[model samples]
Target chain A: MKIAHHAHKDIVIPNSTRHLVTVRQAVFDVIQESGFPEHEMLRIALAIDEALSNIMEHAFETENLKAELTINLSLDADEEKFEALILDSGKEFDPGEIESPDILTHVASGQKTGLGIFLMRQVMNEVKYTFVSGFRNELRMIKYAHDFKTKGATNAGTQDHYQNH
Target chain B: MPELKITTKIIDHDITLIRLVGFLDAHTFEELDVVINDLFEKNIHKIVADLSALEYISSAGAGVFIGALAAAQENSGNIILAAANENIHEVFDLLGLTQIFTMTDSVETAAKAFECNA
Candidate 1:
């Protein structure tokens, strides 16, 4: 098997959950080509899925906007890291505002959602949110190869960072 | 339009074993929800989710089980998760669901879990 030293791909999909599977597959393929372990690749793909789902559910649906919306997604993978950039022209929402829920309390309360951002933060090494007034919201997430190798399938030492620019 | 496929089999006359294949994400979670809801309407609650063939699961898919757990327990039944591949299990582990749900190695073990609880 030949390994691609560096790979970059871009995808644009309507702001709907229907396209999440395709996007996840695309991310997985790119990360696989970069030679990330299957486990790590799955985590990276999952983080991207959560981010996109958040944008669709919270960023667009919250405002009751019915206009046709689209999301721009870019995937870049190399020996050191895999990065995903999601750009959308939806509401200015920062994931940092939501506190991580107590798992016991959350499940006991009969809540079915609100765990996407938490999962994204757990899987990605960096999750930065940038919004330019009157423009678009950009969410950048990166997972480092070293982090996954050291952390051993858990987010034990991973730190969650969010930035608004 | 979603990529998930859900098939159900009744085991031990009461437990419904749902085998999931393909991706279960925001697009297809509602299908699982509807299946569980229909079971609840029929007063059947003991469930063992056979996930050996399930390739992926996202938060939305996990939410269906979280949302149904309470109702199943209140009805003197339970939901057991079985044979989740490493990736699928990681999603549950990430959400702290491992502590809340009983996961087994096979459908036989999961079916016995319902018996053990009973």
Candidate 2:
């Protein structure tokens, strides 16, 4: 099935260390409705992770960095794709240029820091980022159903129309 | 509004146990990284993430694990995930993270494993 069966969700989370998951669920719905597989959902989720995590770690500096962050989830009706955008008025940090650590070798050797954005690229078809108003960082990613590839009758819980591989 | 709650503590020496009792997504994710990373800075070599209370973990949350693992390694430490349910466990297995991070049924087991290796 195409993204014609797509849906969307949006939310605003307080810029506190305690509010990251509320944002992730919003991104989850966007990816789920796009008809993509589980892997894609994780990738889009990573992008959001990298961006939001940076804010909590660096932007706040002190405990008073309490601000407001907004997240939006939308689906494309024609292309069978899902999109999620996160907007925050935190300091500027470019996830696009952040060097991703090699997780394969690290995890194998029992070591692990730089693979956050790398995995995001792996599952997402398109990832774009920009900083507006010098304070608001916008991060977005798209997932296509063709990547994971499912077949057979998808009697798997929520995803009724989409089948298994 | 009793949305999601996160609790953290040190269990069995260097292992910092972060118990996430709610959803894992954009809103609550960074809090984990910040707290865990802070613990990482103080040289907490072993991390056990008890997700038994977590009802949902989005892809972004998975990325946080990857990133945290990497950070831990940089500091000569490690992060292991424990008590993941079917849905969250499926997310981990699909991303091949089940292999990357040790997955166990209980935090006690994870702590024991960490101590065993240490």
Q: Evaluated with lDDT, which candidate comes out highest?
A: 1
TM-score of each: 0.92, 0.54
Candidate 1: tens digits of C-alpha lDDT, residues B1-118: 3388899999888999999988889888999999999999999999999999989899999999999999999999998999998888989999999999999999999998888878
Which candidate comes out best when scored by TM-score? 1
Report per-candidate TM-score of chain A alone: 0.87, 0.62
Off by over 4 Å in 1: A62-67, A148-165
Instruction: For candidate 1, write residues A115-148 as lDDT tens digits.
Output: 9988988888777788877788888887887875
TM-score (chain B only), all candidates:
0.96, 0.90
lDDT of each: 0.86, 0.62
Give a tens-digit lDDT track for model 2, residues B7-33. 888787667888888776655566777
Global CA lDDT computed for model 2 = 0.62
